[model samples]
Target: MKLTSALLLIFIAVHALIADGTVEGKLSVDLMKPSPSRPGYLPSPTKHPVLKPESAPAIVYLERDDGQYPRLKTNETAQIRQSGYQFHPSMVAIQTGAKVNFPNLDDEFHNVFSCSKAKHFDLGRFRKEEISSDVLFNKPGVVKIYCEIHQHMRCFVVVLDTPWFVKTDPEGKFSMKNIPAGDYWLRIFQPSERRIQERVTVMEGQTNTLNFTR
Candidate 1:
């Protein structure tokens, strides 16, 4: 009887370890009018207007109520390319301590710099041939990047301490899976918009759906 009880306890522990949940949601926000593309040094013959969502490409993340989470291992480097006098994918989300590379694909020189509290640095002007070194984001907060040479070029990088973070699609749809079942605080961040937060409970082997509109 003692041996049987021990085996049953082990099985229960194993089951708990494998328990996970999923979170999925969508976001709706005011649409932003397309910005007219400025003429670049190497301008193309034809120009196409680019449309974007206001305060968009939001970031959604889950944080445990108890503030217990495993440290994220930094092994991969993210990239934000500079082309046609603009920052490609104007927004990005990354785990704290990760590195980001700003590759200039344009013929003119670009200077990348940020004055945000989370990080402050300036990568002097560099062209396509002389790419600047990668920037390491060690703090958790929003870092707003800009080009010193071009007033129209801008980008935002959100550094999060939690690993359970994902970016919303162009249509505002987002989903995250394989999160450990527990109580957590779900939060969302978007450029030029107010932050949103809410309490959420995750059940083992279950999925939770939530939505936000602004």
Candidate 2:
């Protein structure tokens, strides 16, 4: 009986470790129309003239109501490269406290800085050969980045407090797996549109689907 009880305890522990859920969804938005201009906001220039609906990507994340979540650290470093006088891949979503490397591939000097309330820093002037160190995003919110030398150069960094975050693909599809079963506030962030949030429940060993349209 003792041996049987020990085996049962081990099985319960293993099951608890694997008791997680998946969240998947698709985002629909009209990006062809220009986003409404806001006061004191300088629109960033894009290389393309006409934009498709999927051209504007969005970030989807889950946040707990109590503002408590597991702290997950990763050795991986996200990158936003400076090339062709612009910041390639203008949008990035990362967990809070992640590091982002801004590597300059252009021969000319670039100055990356942001006055956003979430994070504020200036990566002084540097060229391709003199790359600046990685920047750490410790706060949760949007950080709009710009180059002092080039007015058209702009990018965004979305720092999320929860580790369960994913960026929608060009087709506006996104999926997040291994999320512990619980109630969470599923939120979406889009540059051209207002933010959206809804309450969602994830069941153990099951998948939850939620779609957003704008």
Best by TM-score: 2
Top model number, lDDT:
2
Error of 1 at 151 (Å): 1.0
In model 2, residue pairs whose N, Cα or C atoms come closer than 3 Å (at least 3 residues apart or on different chains), thus clashing, are none
lDDT of 1 by residue, 25-80 (tens): 99874332234356665433323332232344878899887766776565758998
Q: Per model, how many backbone clashes are there?
A: 0, 0
| TM-score quality measure for candidate 1 | 0.80
lDDT of 2 by residue, 159-209 (tens): 998888988888889999889899999998886646888999999988899
Per-residue lDDT of 157 in model 1? 90
For each candidate in turn, the TM-score is 0.80, 0.80
* lDDT against true structure, model 1: 0.79
RMSD list, candidates in order:
5.7, 5.2
Cα misplacement distance, residue 142 of candidate 2 (Å): 0.6
Residue 153 of candidate 2: its Cα lDDT? 67
